[model samples]
Target chain A: MNYPNGSKQIPRSSQKLNSNETIFSNRGMTLEEDINATNDYYLDACLAVIHKKPTPVQIVKVDYPKRSAAVIKEGYFKQASTTDYNGVYRGKYVDFEAKETKNKTSFPLSNIHQHQVNHMKAVINQGGICFLIIRFAAFDETYLFQAHHLFEHWDNQFKGARKSIKYEQIRENGYFIPFAYQARVNYLSIVDQVYF
Target chain B: MNYPNGSKQIPRSSQKLNSNETIFSNRGMTLEEDINATNDYYLDACLAVIHKKPTPVQIVKVDYPKRSAAVIKEGYFKQASTTDYNGVYRGKYVDFEAKETKNKTSFPLSNIHQHQVNHMKAVINQGGICFLIIRFAAFDETYLFQAHHLFEHWDNQFKGARKSIKYEQIRENGYFIPFAYQARVNYLSIVDQVYF
Candidate 1:
């Protein structure tokens, strides 16, 4: 079936969900599916090459039921040491974490881990574009908040600053991702506006 | 304990295997370990931000015995669709696969999968740097062969060309990665020569 850009075939996993369905059920579509579809669109157009890192799993034991396939009998989820999505956009490194909140008023700082904040700092220090994609699921709005802005709030938290960032603050500092027909979450346009 | 790059502390996992051990047993050090150490050195020196993608696993069942932890009860390995290593180097996307051969005659083409070749092609098409790090273990020589050159050989195979690339062809076409005290496998230096 034809996808967003209609240039590349739909990914096997995302074949069941189409842009039309996503548009009709915007609230039902998870932020991840939207981003994944958007990434597929970007990839088809050769605009950027970004990918969400696979969830890390720590294996404890394995059983070799067959010579070719070894089954993991025991394992646990491991805390990721870096951001969810990262890649190159227009010959520049891009890194960011995607998160969503049901709360319409504020985004809780507790949703982000300390290590991830440190990782984004490292990426930014090394001259890479780093940011956070904050989605207010209740309002069906998503914003791209730069890492520097995120750091300012994160640093103040240790000095008794508010543990959550008000939605108004995000709206003020972040760029709104325009929802589009082909590109559901058109954040790269904002990346071009800010970074270019 | 000090690592090869004395600037950075030894990684927790590699603390047991110090530089001295790696140096003394160069033959014993797996290509994966060498590349990991090299990547760590690059990261510590702020030269590059590259990483090996985690082995993908397909989880079948999970048991949450505690509120804090979830144990995976059943899982299986999932074949990766891209190169093993990818990251940003000097604001450009870099993707590569590392392979080692005990064979003195030729590097076998069978070692690489078709999907990885396609992935590298896509990366290159999007203005990214993609290559292969082929190590002839017996000679302790590693070479950075660009994906284009690898592709030429790979494509010609179907037209009655050799199934494996000769060591002499690689020696002629690929840049040699100098062995170093700090970087262990100094492939980036060759990257500087070829790409920069």
Candidate 2:
């Protein structure tokens, strides 16, 4: 079966969602894959522009096999210097990080790195639209939290207010990113309501 | 010498440049290092905000040596889906790709792939700034050409234009990115000149 170049294929993999099905059993889709499909749909519909940050790798050895795709035999992961998913929407720069949490009640700071926090701050400083799309998978809910609010809590992280943001706090601070059949994570609608 | 963390010190390797040595003996500075230093200066001086796209990778195996850091034991290079550099400059969103060409006469279409071309077109369609920076190493000349021109040439590939863009044609259609001691590529100067 063609995976449709994105994670949406999980739903299309079979007519029924069952515990035994690999698609149903394996979290169905990762946050990254969902965002990828969402971006593809956005590109197709011309609503807004965004793309996932590339995986950071240090290429050490490349194998050139004739009549086949070049296989990277050896490489190392490099630290990312910026946040993933950035582009323009209605003339405003849109930048964000997508994260999923198994916890039903909160989003964890441990799930984020300091570098990512700093990168989002930098994006906000540049007159760009910056936010975080967080998914509480257990609750099957996603929230769009603006960078300023995220940093506010992050600033208080040293004081140990909360390691992860509570669902209640997120509900107060973030806009709900409604899911659609075509655009799975339609955060731009929230962006239009908030940043734009 | 410190080589961006985790890279072992190889005992004054022959390829190691003096602190001030230019890279490839043509661009005056390695693209990665110069982009970092330029970003540092940009952050310090509050100039237009721009950054090099993070290196892309696919992590296959990772060892959690300590909670603070994960040692990536195995990974592969994933094809990049976007340009090499992008950010917000003033109020405009900026995005671009940087490439070095050995061919002195023309830039080849083989250097770019379909996905990247689609990404650039999407960025432009969203009203963001997009372009490519080409370094003709033989002549030590750098040129910034808009993605539209690239798309046009690439589209014409089916109609049977030259497979590559001539250096003379590039000179006519593209702007020469000024060399700078600090910024190196200094492509933003040309952005201001052309776009602003």
Candidate 3:
């Protein structure tokens, strides 16, 4: 039930698509699950109000049954224009995307979208705390890489530079988020240390 | 193309389901559209980073082709647990729901869901700027009613109080958001006035 990172594995039998169970621990405690648990802990303690934006769906056809909620018979998942999670922390705007990579030496740029990069820039320009929660899944390590740092590497990609950030570079520039018991990923502590 | 409240109706011919057009002008520029335009203007000016949460959907079936993106074949609308619009403004967590009522005397409690009330309470308890943007369509009037003021009346509903908050009460407690040329609803200016 528990992973090496101290995250509890939620039972697959209890996974429900319509519920918060999307972030449950069945297929290895994904970086998302730990963050969700952390957000829940934060919410319970009145710490912050961060939430993962719901997956966007384009509804095409609907069946209006007799006296029942309308059922969408056809739809398509649409790519999100912003980051995965966003909210307020200590009276500051907090926004970030969580990405997992099994690659050992680097975090790939292709994992992120152009609009997401633009969104981070907008948030930063608006004086918000924006970053990337990069999980090197194979090594069980997570880092809070600031949006500006990511932007540097992203901009270099246009000049035929490396399409990924070296692990060494990330270790130097990014703040490591320690895996904790109740706090799970413990990224906000890094946010406080880095931003505050 | 302009509604009575100064919101511009997005041309129906240009509406796209998967686009932000869902929040665009139509139906005489619903309050949602005006707010969306204001949010867009704010984003462009690097003022704030507010966004309306996408409508939640419970996807039941999806199809994956060899070369294309996944397509959701069946889904159903899911009632949201939180407010419709939320983001960061002036380094503070800002959240609110926009509602329009034709009733001239009072804003009906039935217009809001119990879960939404609970969500607002949670945000306010955590030090967020929470409120309601209620528009009286018939009167061409709008008010930014704070969540705490709304909660007082909501709690009273269980103790045999009236099912609606009278317009006079809203006029006394809520800040009026003026319609502006470029920003549409100009709610953030009201936010700046009230909170900053």
Q: Please give the clash total of every predicted structure, in order.
A: 0, 4, 2
Tens digits of per-residue lDDT, candidate 2, A62-126, equal 77778976566655567776787888887678888888988877788887789888878777777
Candidate 2, which segments miss by more than 4 Å at Cα? A1-27, A59-74, B1-37, B58-76
What ranking of all candidate models by TM-score puts the best one first?
A: 1, 3, 2
Docking class of 3: acceptable
lDDT of 1 by residue, B115-173 (tens): 88877777888778889999888877777888998999899999999999998888778
* Model 3 regions more than 4 Å off: A1-27, B1-27
**Candidate 1: residue B194 Cα off by (Å):** 1.8
Full candidate order by lDDT, most accurate first: 1, 3, 2
List, residue by residue over B1-196, the lDDT tens digit for candidate 2.
Answer: 1121233322111345678875433345555565567667776667766777765766777667655555556555567877777788776888887778889789988888888898888888889899988877776767788899899999999898878888877878887665566666666777776777
Backbone clash pairs for candidate 2 read A55-B56, A55-B57, A56-B55, A56-B57
Error of 3 at B27 (Å): 7.9
Q: Arrange candidates by DockQ, descending.
A: 1, 3, 2
Question: lDDT tens digits, residues B100-132, model 3?
Answer: 998989999999999899778878776778899
* Residue B194 miss distance in model 3 (angstroms): 0.7
A92 in model 1: Cα distance from truth in Å? Answer: 2.2
Q: Enumerate residue pairs that collide in model 3.
A: A91-B91, B10-B25
Cα lDDT tens digits, model 3, A76-162, are 788898898987777677899999999989999999999999988878877778999998876677788999999999999999999
Best by TM-score: 1
